[model samples]
Target: MIAPDPLYPVLETERLRLLCPAAPDFDAMAAYLAPGTRDFVDLPPDPESAWWSVATTIGHWHLRGYGHFAVVDRRSGEHFGLVGPWFPHGWPEPELSWQLLDGAEGRGIATEAARAVLDWLFLEKGWSSCISMIAPGNARSLALVERLGARSEGMFHHRLTGELRIWRHVARTATGRKLMEGFA
Candidate 1:
């Protein structure tokens, strides 16, 4: 039962909370990023690498203003995973990225959090479009993106994550023009 960083915006869905990747989320994230057969992330198979990954996530918010949100259970305050807007170096454009802890699987946490993030990115931030890169054989991830109604544009050969299938999503609203536009 740890609290998320309050410096960043805290978004809430029906059953979860999306908060900044503060220090408290490290242990959970480390376990999720643990070395395994899964190639969900491209970090080196070293113990210290998880710390750096967590550090980078914290820095990402400072650098980009908006980054992945630590998914926490509203009632329990436990970090389930991370899901949100992500744009790292070498990426062709901003993407909707997601990763989940084992406990969070098969419970619709990713889908719920992703929808909330999409609304923030497209409706609140007024982003035009976004893409999600999924590992080739990650059925859960591929299915999640499909459920979100994203279409496969093609494969993108990431410098770190290797070749991944790209799913594209566009804002339903046309261009998200601000209501206060042209008033001044």
Candidate 2:
């Protein structure tokens, strides 16, 4: 029988370990959910759903060659959450995204994790561009994208999910070019 490919764990940031998600991460995934953390993911909160989420992350490694990562605390080794190149549920292009546990939010961990993942995607993976999808009502995320130098080109239905919202950014700017060029 063919063995499974080994998980490729990425670099750990100041407060987070940006590593590949694994089946053993189900416990960590379960710990990631709180009252409203799933608001932006399109998936509802439930124990079974958490399993499905982790499985889907594992599947991304095989299908897309990359996907969301398991974010754990550097000092305590606690799972902060998942953050990395997410392509939505069924989209073709990958996007940079993050979700921190309730206690881990508001600490710039998402932004830190995303910056590292985005850098790695371009530098290590040779990817040219990346995007993030945010619900119009999600002001915090929108602000984060803006801080990252992503500018909105307007709204459109997510080709894979058909969800409608104002798209935050198409990633056109000197900063965007610098990021992609740094990889070159």
Candidate 3:
């Protein structure tokens, strides 16, 4: 039998905790993404996809060695949303992504969590690059990637998901690692 993953550590920032998602997290995840979370995917996702979404999140820890983190309100312990790496099976590369609960918008939670994950990926994991794919119509995500200093690489059809524009950030030197370490 497979051993269980340790309880996710609390990734404490001055104002947030980017913890790993668990079964209990699904309710808040669902509620946070309510009105429509699947609609945010590049392709039309199942409206009832929360169960699989959670499983996939767990699977990331086992397979990819990293995964999306649940953004918890530091003080209240409320579940906010998630920001981290996701790679569907057989995909060429992992994508950095986020989804903030409705109330958590405009507060920079996504940006903070994403930067933290990127820093971990680079410094701790020795990854040189990571990418984010955005739908042309998703201005919010586009703006977030830009703010994170990721540049648009190009557009491509996902074959299964229609059109997607790829944005990437690569660290050639250790400079970004230092900057990211300072954020934690």
Candidate 4:
């Protein structure tokens, strides 16, 4: 396996800290995998599965040079979510995604964290664009994507997750003057 970026960044928003996933974060993330708490995102339903999920997230960094960051509350220092770029084997496109823990919703945390990650992806990583494959009927995610300025391109049937609406990210200028400018 390839070595991960030793200088992997710690992204900061006004209310959140986006850190690389670590072993200590597994239990917190796993708590969200419990029944009634899990929705939209389909994580397996056991501690071992949670371990593998966290492992896969960390491993994605080694393989792809970039991956999700564990989203933490700046004040409480809680691991509230994961957000960033992801492109696994056979993925339709490189995606910017997010998943927040219970009680973390409706706080604009995902949008803030995602804006930071998108700035890094476009400005530092030099990616031209990315996509968000939002599940149909996920109104919250659809609204978030719209808030990010991503337009709905069309639908795609994910190899694993079945049908999803593919939202294409709005392209930024070479000077990084759009989409995430306010966050930058």
State how far residue 70 of model 1 sits from its true place (Å).
Answer: 0.3
Task: Find the candidate with the highest TM-score and give its number.
Answer: 4
Task: Check candidate 2 and list the clashing pairs.
Answer: 152-168
Residue 36, model 3, lDDT: 41
Q: Write the per-residue lDDT of candidate 1 for residues 87-157, one digit (tens) a residue.
A: 88999899999878656789999999998888777767778678999998999998999988788889899
Candidate 4 lDDT, 1-184, residue by residue in tens: 1114445667788888788764343354554454434441465456666766767887898788889887777798776778989998878879999988777789898899888888788767788689999998899999999998888888888668899889877558756466444432
Residue 88 alpha-carbon offset, candidate 4, angstroms: 1.2
TM-score of 2: 0.73
Query: Candidate 3 — which residues are off by over 4 angstroms?
Result: 1-9, 22-49, 172-184
C-alpha lDDT values of all predictions: 0.75, 0.64, 0.69, 0.76
lDDT tens digits, residue span 32-123, model 2: 45455475345777767766776787788777778887776779777667787766565535667777666767888888877777666666
Whole-structure CA lDDT of model 4: 0.76
Q: What TM-score does candidate 4 get on C-alpha atoms?
A: 0.80
Distance from true position, residue 100, model 4, in Å? 0.9
Model 1, residue 182: distance off in Å is: 25
Alpha-carbon deviation at 143 in model 3, angstroms: 0.8
Error of 3 at 98 (Å): 0.9
